[model samples]
Target chain A: MGQRPGDLSAPARLAGPDEGIGADELALATRNHGLPLEALRHDVTPPGLHYVLTHYDIPYVPDAGAWRLTVDGHVRTPLDLSLADLLSFPQVTTRVTLECAGNGRALLTPRPVSQPWLVEAVGTADWTGVPLRRLLAEAGADPAAVDVVFTGADHGVERGVEQDYQRALPLSVATGDDPQVLVATAMNGAPLPPQHGRPLRLIVPGWYGMAQVKWLRSVTVGDVPFTGFQQSVAYRIRRTPDEEGEPVTRIAPRALLVPPGFPDFMSRTRVVRPGPVRLSGRAWSGQAPVSSVEVSTDGGAHWEPAVLDPVVDGHRWAWRAWHHTWTATPGEHAVGTRASDADGHVQPLDQHWNRGGLANNAVCFVRVVCVADACWP
Target chain B: MGQRPGDLSAPARLAGPDEGIGADELALATRNHGLPLEALRHDVTPPGLHYVLTHYDIPYVPDAGAWRLTVDGHVRTPLDLSLADLLSFPQVTTRVTLECAGNGRALLTPRPVSQPWLVEAVGTADWTGVPLRRLLAEAGADPAAVDVVFTGADHGVERGVEQDYQRALPLSVATGDDPQVLVATAMNGAPLPPQHGRPLRLIVPGWYGMAQVKWLRSVTVGDVPFTGFQQSVAYRIRRTPDEEGEPVTRIAPRALLVPPGFPDFMSRTRVVRPGPVRLSGRAWSGQAPVSSVEVSTDGGAHWEPAVLDPVVDGHRWAWRAWHHTWTATPGEHAVGTRASDADGHVQPLDQHWNRGGLANNAVCFVRVVCVADACWP
Candidate 1:
């Protein structure tokens, strides 16, 4: 097989800011203050290290003492709900992974003209909030409403357009029976941080981060598809200005290798004896449960099925851990991992080229060296 | 000196796009429709090979027969001038090099989110047009005007902001005595191509390409600086979301090596005998003329002065050629080059990190192998 665009023979490093994820309580990744890949090693990412991708620089922190979320526009009964009112409704909690649409964008060829993300821009979090369907029902959303637009308080001019960060979902998805679609107020059993979303946020499970409007202020029911900047222009894949490609939506099937974090050069510290070396990582998909994961130790020439952890109910968006034990040799080697979902949506060896570089889920690899005389850890 | 972020020991190639510069009559460079670094080999770059960068996918092609440039807002005489009217006015021509602010961005560490550009996103061309100062003068621009906002016909939404491709210049720079600041209608003695701004374009000498509003439709004089999305937010370099860094404007001092383009593996077609090899390239700066250029054949450890070419009058933005001769060694070696401008602005061995990855002018190097028995070219 031909080498992928970003699969360099030597380890590749990006230039500019340092993106080291230190042992700090709150480790901040480099671009847009995102989470580091280290955070994904945990079955449930720590709240502090959960990737936070905000559109605006200053995330809006509503004064809980006076903040209100107004539900109107194409509603039979307009409603204004405060924090207390939102909390009064029955709450739903779910563990879901939110990946940036631009994840792995840096790996794209010809390169898109936006955030150049590697594969680290994703995190899974346990969110507690009221089901969005309940709020829409309480507000008596009009049957004719075709879409529900979620508007955030974060407003800024991007390109040349002045806009409040907004995105719309088809009414079917907005008012679906899926209890995972939430108007979230708390995360990891704590109130949302100002950087995440203070008073309220929209968490659309299985969708990319853009669909989960942070710092959410209002939910409006509209009779037509929202033609907001974020919906119609910014997020859609376009080969040219005139050609409108599909709008980015769900997360693609992906598997991430977590062991052997250090490269081969750091063999003095990371190398193991010529014995069995255990490898583990996580696999996920938006369309279905992770059905299987495969590991390759000879640069993908041979593959072996990995043992997957049992799936838990009610966490459809949660990733599944997979493990493999490899008998090591006393030399350098490349290891790779790939996953397939229950729907048979398998991770591609390489990502399909897109103008916006969205939805990249190419297989990931790590290089490791084994020391002949070293003892097992 | 330590290796810079992108100065890999081996010659590195950009991922995704095939940025090949064909050897046709025009020799158009691939990837963003830009000019290849090889085009800079000639003191006066061939018109056909000149680079073109367009924001929108479809370049706006105005009907020359009906196109009108409107000059209004804070102007004493609001005028709608046709192509003929623009042609009737006295014209000015100047050779200027235009570079994208994101040039060399791919080389930045941590990688800023935007076009992952290498160093090739720049070009020089002789532009013919009416001096913008003259046009503003004819319109009787108000003396109190603080900025001149140039608006292009191209419109699109970027990052959720809907904007006509627009940029603003401080009044002084917009109406300066510099004849290079033009309302360009022709490039390299030919009518501008649609992709190069067919009807009219603003040519702000020394500024990055963003300041050159292409497909010009209207010029608005304003009492306050234009706080357009591209100006106040998107282009600024920020360390954090809240701390606004300075807006990027002028091009930084930079020098690029031209010859020895292919790396060692391709030496069969490009290698020369183990003797003195002549090397040449171009240098330019927004603040001042390039004062000196240094070349290093053994990584960046040793450096020697290169012969600087004489500067031509009126082509202030044009890069000057620098030449060096290196005795060949029959082995692989890394060659590097850097430049210093007259204003004491020296090219840094490494780039200062910026969030937008703007204005990267780090020292660049190329890897080549000398053939032992080949005769000198």
Candidate 2:
């Protein structure tokens, strides 16, 4: 996880059985607005269990004490600053979702051939960091430095390819003040856990987890593009059928892109343990925020609007949890849900096929299993 | 790893050394070429320390249990054969390189963000698999089936949007008897490495790694484009800068776009041990076989044809190993190398920048380090 600055592993864990106390690990604590993993029942993904994507293995990075962000690639005034130097500037926090580009690649058309991933491929957290613009101004970055190179403490060789843990972003995005963009050192209001990037990380709200690099390191202002494999190669989208089969290079605006609704825990089988079963799940968009999440008790005929939480940070990629309630039932029935963003985007009727399994925002039908008695397999 | 068959978290290991010392591994050994390393090396990459990218974690997957090659989807007679079923048919071999679509992305312009890989991504290897033609004929694939979807054994989630681990080649490529399209179970004549995908992988020479789906599960026949995430969203090439200030989308044929020549040991500092230092490395083409190789000691000013071994396959992505003998030097000098294919295709000065870093076959360079009898630090 020492590859990028804000890599995603898990953040919290119980120190003693008493740690991670009630509500402390709750999703609301972060305002990510997602459903509880009622199946797992416990709040918050424990550190070890949190999803992780580390470009390089654990890197022994320069201490925050000596850490400096250098801006000189194609910049006017080359600037270098220590952690304290970085912190000397203003700071802000934003709640956002960091999902790996490869998170759902397994379901791709050619089955994106990369690392395997599981359900625990994403998480949300509050990030605090200096605005990239602030650093750019200080460095007097040249517009010619169209790209910014980000280096890390991890290094390795892959496929006869000598690689340094690094990647580059367009100066446009790097210079913007996305509240979701953070030079974060904490998670859930605590210093980052080792697995979650102990010292610092770059929390890129809507982009895939790969962009939100883990481990605090150096940021270089460059003229040409940074040629890190992660930047130039992996985590891209291939839209056409051609000889070289070029890739979708830049990050697409974040959008849920599918099944236009928050998931609902309809018709609970928790007959005895429940007064009235409450249904809940998270809905979000990368391209646009949610317009209104719709739920259907009978497949696609009848529809109802689920309660919406206040959207914050203008983060479209961060999902909002929507909840519904249903009385206990005696048998199996079909229940489906869909979500749409502010742009009137609706979930698809079926799957759209592509090479890699990316942008899979599709309508999901969660079959409700209610019983006269609590009987779950 | 199980959820995504090709994920890195699998338990696939190098089976007790010789567990993989079969025909495929033997092929590599017989040539006395290449150094296989378990991990990366520092500075000058030891032949043994080069990285290897495999489709599957386990190697040498036979059709023994459930390794069935299916041509379902929209085909006439969906072919579902076992490993042996595939091998029994006339087998063929090709010398080609399997490169990640993200290979030369590091050289892109906008500097789309992702992995931090230095050069050394592309590698060539010998591969033997079933001709897609043979299986297509046997499956009685309908002429109407415009595209053939190649699937893998890995389990994955599917968005109603798209949930398929498959790639589709026009019926022409899929049905071509060209020996290059293979259901390869071995690499370099040995059981394929797990990471490289064992139990039979697809070797579609002349394209990026995306075309070669490792741990092949099933091959389906479809009349439509495979709309999986990998196909649609991943691997897309961003053309020129757009009005949206984002990368555009398109696809090109994928290949190991490398500059001409075998690797020239960039030894800036000479080795004290004057023993013959063998110059060796692998080479392959995305669309064709490498016809010849050359090396330069004085920066491409003078050139000499280097020794190239007999490559294994034709018009395949499987790569070949080339080596040469060089005398030790104790002075500072520059070295460069280049390679060309049968079709006269040579490496480019640089790849055209697209949003996604996909196929980039630029020539490779090594700055030899030869000191006055100084030990490599």
Candidate 3:
């Protein structure tokens, strides 16, 4: 092969200073950016079907033989442990619904300048790991510690700032009796994929995914609150850079309609024979258990309560499945769903406007055509 | 659960006439938009890892019990065959590389306003299908037929045009003993996934993905070329509305550098050791087989020929792997690769600008940092 003159040099200009790379570069930086929204139409999301978001191209897979995790800082004892050591600790497995802080960012009016995630940036997974509280207790935390910071292996430049992936939580949330906060090593009963953060990752159940740092390398307990780039800069919900916006935490109540996905030739709606059409979906809340869910079939003009599955093990992080049976109809129709948590937070008709578009629980509606018969024109 | 005041009615406006839905709508309409660029770094893309581009939300999975494939139009005898009948025809399984016509559209200067794909919209798969020639012969295609039109089950409004997904090829290419032209029933040894087009889909080897209609319903031979919405309007390349631009077909020769995606703290380059590092990737062409591949280590100032894997067969639809080894010195470096086809069509330094941003075969480069010893700091 001989050198082609224009080929090699032209693309280099794209990386130059004058022409700043735009959304296209951000879109290309990760392998699997997000999952298709249709993926949410399923109750139990398959591991491969799960959505993925990363700070960088999937970080290198560390050699299992040499990997280590360190816990240090204001604690009485600084602990450095191998993967084997961590595994030996009492293991806990729990199902948790994780939503990215930027989940509904795309729907934000005047859209936030970020990953442009749609509704599919959320998923529920059965994570297996050691509890973070147990690990912190073993390290003997200092009383003066105010925040616990978790660091990941992935790093990149974003908004002209270079940093490794880092996020923090208050000491109270980190060391609580809730066994749901885990140092997850496996997802869906299998070892975490590299993109999902292999070997070790933090699972801050109920909070947005940003707190669940992947490829966990260190945990530091600090006397002062950790004001890391990811914590104070990127994920904050502020209109301007000067404002100290609220840190996004705890997902809002949201319910999705899992249609049967049958195709209809008229009006972009799924076609179903005139009979009982079973509509089902999964719903969850970060701060409380989902108390109930409601469905609307006439463009929100009418609504009905849906049956909710019994909660499993009083886990606040897990999502509850909801089902509603719509009786026979033979015309165009739209289906919408909403959920209310025990905390009295009902899914909103319209999302509260936030600059970052974080925690948008706006009700989602799907259109379907109820056909008289199952015959194609 | 009772209906909240604004919750039900608010979201109805999103599907309104004034404000057309944006990215969130587009993302929900397809199962897979494009492959993550990082996924292209792998040699044999896993079945699930393959990129998917569809006209609609994976059209409701067709009922296998009622599916049929009809062959008519300009044929001496029409044939409506069931799944079993088509499966009984001698199967021809072949590995083929499929690239979206809009593959590198995102990188175009003054970027095209489309799916915004950036280089990862290509993959190779082993497809098991009955040859189109066999099917056409069985139906007795008419001597006057000039084009063969393939129609898919998907239909929707794009660019204000409502129509079913359709495309066509000259009768010569359709029925010419090219075993590569397939009526694919399976991919990678399993039944095709709904997202990838279940039951049946057409595989026009070496052509851009648009020509490979999914959820194929019928193969119609016509006396004249087909002028459907997807064929005459959408996939064509033109700078102005008045110009009846040429239709995009056949994959172009392109090369990509598959770097070891290691993490580097200093720059966004892959981290490597201070010794020899081997870089490799795949290259392919539509008009001809990949003749050779070249690598550039110091930007584009120097180039060296890389070893290309022997062609597996005369099938020009598949890709060939290329590898290059470089003696490394500590520091950062950019790696680039380019390929030339047997037809003397070398990968372009810069892609020619197109209105729809189709047929982008520009060269690709990757960056890496060589560290001293194995220390990250």
Residue-wise C-alpha lDDT for candidate 1, range A264-310, written one tens digit per residue: 11011133456788888788888778899999988788899999988
The superposed Cα distance between candidate 2 and the true structure at residue B195, in angstroms, equals 31
**Candidate fnat values, all:** 0.00, 0.00, 0.06
Candidate 3 C-alpha lDDT tens digits along B177-289: 55358999988787877667778999888888998889999999999878887788778888765689988988889887665545322123565567778888888988777
TM-score of each: 0.48, 0.42, 0.73
In angstroms, the error of model 3 at A253 is 1.5
lDDT of 3 by residue, A133-241 (tens): 8889999988679999998887654543446888988889898865358998888887886667778999988888888899999999999988887888767777665
| Clash count for each candidate, listed in order shown | 13, 168, 2
Better DockQ candidate (2, 3): 3
Assess each model's interface with DockQ, reporting 2 decimals per model: 0.01, 0.01, 0.10
Native-referenced Cα lDDT, model 3:
0.72
Worst 10 residues of 1 chain A by lDDT: A21-30
Q: What interface root-mean-square deviation (Å) does model 3 yield? A: 10.9
Candidate 1 residues lying further than 4 Å off, grouped into runs, are A1-34, A60-62, A261-273, A373-377, B1-377
Estimate every model's Cα lDDT from 0 to 1.
0.69, 0.48, 0.72
Best by DockQ: 3
Please give the TM-score that candidate 3 achieves against the real structure.
0.73
